[model samples]
Target chain A: MKSFLSLLIAFVAINTELFAAEAGMPQLDPTYWASQAFWLILVFTILYISISKFYLPKIKDNLDNRENKIKEDLENANKFKEESEAKLKEYDLILENAKKEVLKIHFESKSTLDKDIQSKKESMEKEIEKEILKAQKEISELKKNSISSIQIISGSIVSNIIENISGDKLNESSIKATVEDVSKKNMNKFL
Target chain B: MQQFTVQRIGPEINIVGVDLSFTNASLFMVISAAVIMLFLFLGSKEKKVIPNKLQLIAEMSYTFVAKMISDTAGSKARPYFPFIFSLFMFVLFCNMVGMLPYSFTVTSHIIVTLIMALFIFIAVTIIGFIKHGFKYLSIFVPSGVPAVLLPLITIIEIISYLSRPVSLSVRLFANMMAGHTMLKVFGGFVVSLGILGGWLPLSFSVALTGLEILVAFLQAYVFAILTCIYLNDALNLHH
Candidate 1:
């Protein structure tokens, strides 16, 4: 409160004197020019030193740092892009190799299965042919046997019929010889 | 007019017969300088990658002055950036501070502006002489001019060159002083005219105050830009 009071007093005192002055042209007052100029010089020098030494450099550093950071970020982005591109290429190559490998395995398995099937089919056909040939031979043999039996039966019947009808019996030796001769002739015809 | 008067704040001291009294003008000058210093110091403290408002203002002012110097004086004037920057800030602050009610305008005084202008003029002249030697005088002799009119042209050129500091200082001091005086005069009218009649002058005073603000900024810019131009002429020796 005392300080504020003194300040008010000082202000009044200063204004009182300021009012007493004629107020014609303050700029033309030669008495104050020297002091104003001196103060100006002193204050300006101090300001210049402070600005040049400290303030300006800090602002400059901020700008330079931003520039460098941007440059670094750009470089990093470029590097990441290249790396991803390389990875994509590698992935494509691996995928292509896998596809080729799969195709090769498929073809190899197919060929092996075909060969196995073909061999199995060929063996089955050979077995069927052998069985057919054996059955054919048996049929031919049965036909030959049946034909002989039929001839023998027919000769016996003829002999009986001749013996009954004539009432006098022929000689057994002759009959037998005749039958043998006839049967021989008949076998030669059939054969 | 009373506002323009310089009041001594304390006891007057005589140094080698020179009266160096701490006056209102000195106080205001010191205040302006301190304000500039504090503003810059606080504004630049953070140094963030992404700047806040204060930092942005600080940075803007820095670039503003930098661009002004480069535009007017080119790269050769880079070495004198501190002086030019100081002058601009000081003048700009003084002008701005004067806008506050009952505050002193340091730039209103011819001596202050004269000192600054004279210093710039002398410094630039010294630089020109040192760099170009006696050939610096050839600036007065235009190449296309006939020899018959050479003397007249030379004299005119010398006069014009000598008038640079006078015009530079007077331009700032007069503008500031005149604007403040007009404001004071209008303010007086407003007080004397009473409530009903005061409104018109009050409105005019408002308008004039806005104009004065613009003039304040422009005068500072003109002062700094003119300094840069003069510096350019000296440094580059432009024909």
Candidate 2:
């Protein structure tokens, strides 16, 4: 209140000084001051009322709405980006799992195939050994049969030559015994 | 001088002892207010997310004043934004309308500017008192002053404080009045000097008109910013 009163006093003092100095100036005219003041106050009041009541709120709302929309749009964009990133991570995980699956299958099949091959090879080797032993026994029997035939043929020939040369069918048993003894002594050479 | 005269218009009207007669000043004031209202009305009527030129101007003016207040007075001055915005638009439109040929400049009058300044002065003083109580008086006393010089500093501070309204009102009035007067004086020179010699003064008048328009906007800006500064002092009470 003191400040307001002092303000009024100061205003009067300043107005008086200004008015006294510029008495001829039209702005200093006291008669028009009242009307000017009245109209100024009236017009300014209407302006203030209309602005505060009507226009400012409208502008504020528009700005606020636009700001909210922009914020919403930005948030949506961020959400979409994050979603895509998550999808990408999921895709990568699936690809890794598939790769692991393929490796597992490959190892499983490889081990099964290796076991089958090992058994087949073992059976094949057993069959081959059995065939080799049978062939060896057959070859020894053929050799033994050929050697006895040769010995028999040689003894007949020798006996026939001696009968023709000596012109005597001398004692068959003694001849046969001599032939057997000689054959036994010279068997290695004849064969 | 003739331009500044508040000629009576229509019938004489008086209320109490005051001359409530509608004058040219009143008419222009009404015109300025109407122009502002119309501008705001048309600007906000659509309220599109994408604003047209008129709406753009309206929004710009709002934000302009909004930023000005926030910049100078901080958020504490938000409640008074409308008053300050209206004041700026009124003064700006008045000055702009006055720039028209044969138009009377409302701010050229001392009484008009003084009224506004005194009102702001009182309002800000009241706000200061309300906000700080007796501590508001400490505004007149400077800190860090030697005790011996404190009295002189306090007296100076009070005088300066009281002179706020006077200076605020006078600064605007003098600038508008002087700028308009110079333009009129130059215009007279252009007419008095015949065509051949008239070119110089005519050119000078052109330059002065441009300068006056700039001053018109500048004075309104200065007026509003000063009001914000005063509002800041009242609200914050910083030395």
For model 2, residues B148-184, the per-residue Cα lDDT tens digits are 9999999999999999999999999999999987787
What ranges in model 1 sit over 4 Å off?
A: A1-23, A113-191
DockQ of candidate 2 (2 decimals): 0.29
lDDT of 2 by residue, A3-109 (tens): 65565455446645644564467887788889999999999999999999999999999888878988999999999999999999999999999999999999999
Please give the distance, in angstroms, between residue A84's alpha carbon in candidate 1 and its true position after superposition. Answer: 3.4
Give the best candidate by TM-score: 1
Model 2 per-residue lDDT at B210 = 89
* Model 1: per-residue Cα lDDT over A134-180, one tens digit each: 99888889868866676567656666788789867666667666766
User: What level of docking quality does candidate 2 show?
Assistant: acceptable
| TM-score for each candidate, following the candidate numbering | 0.77, 0.74
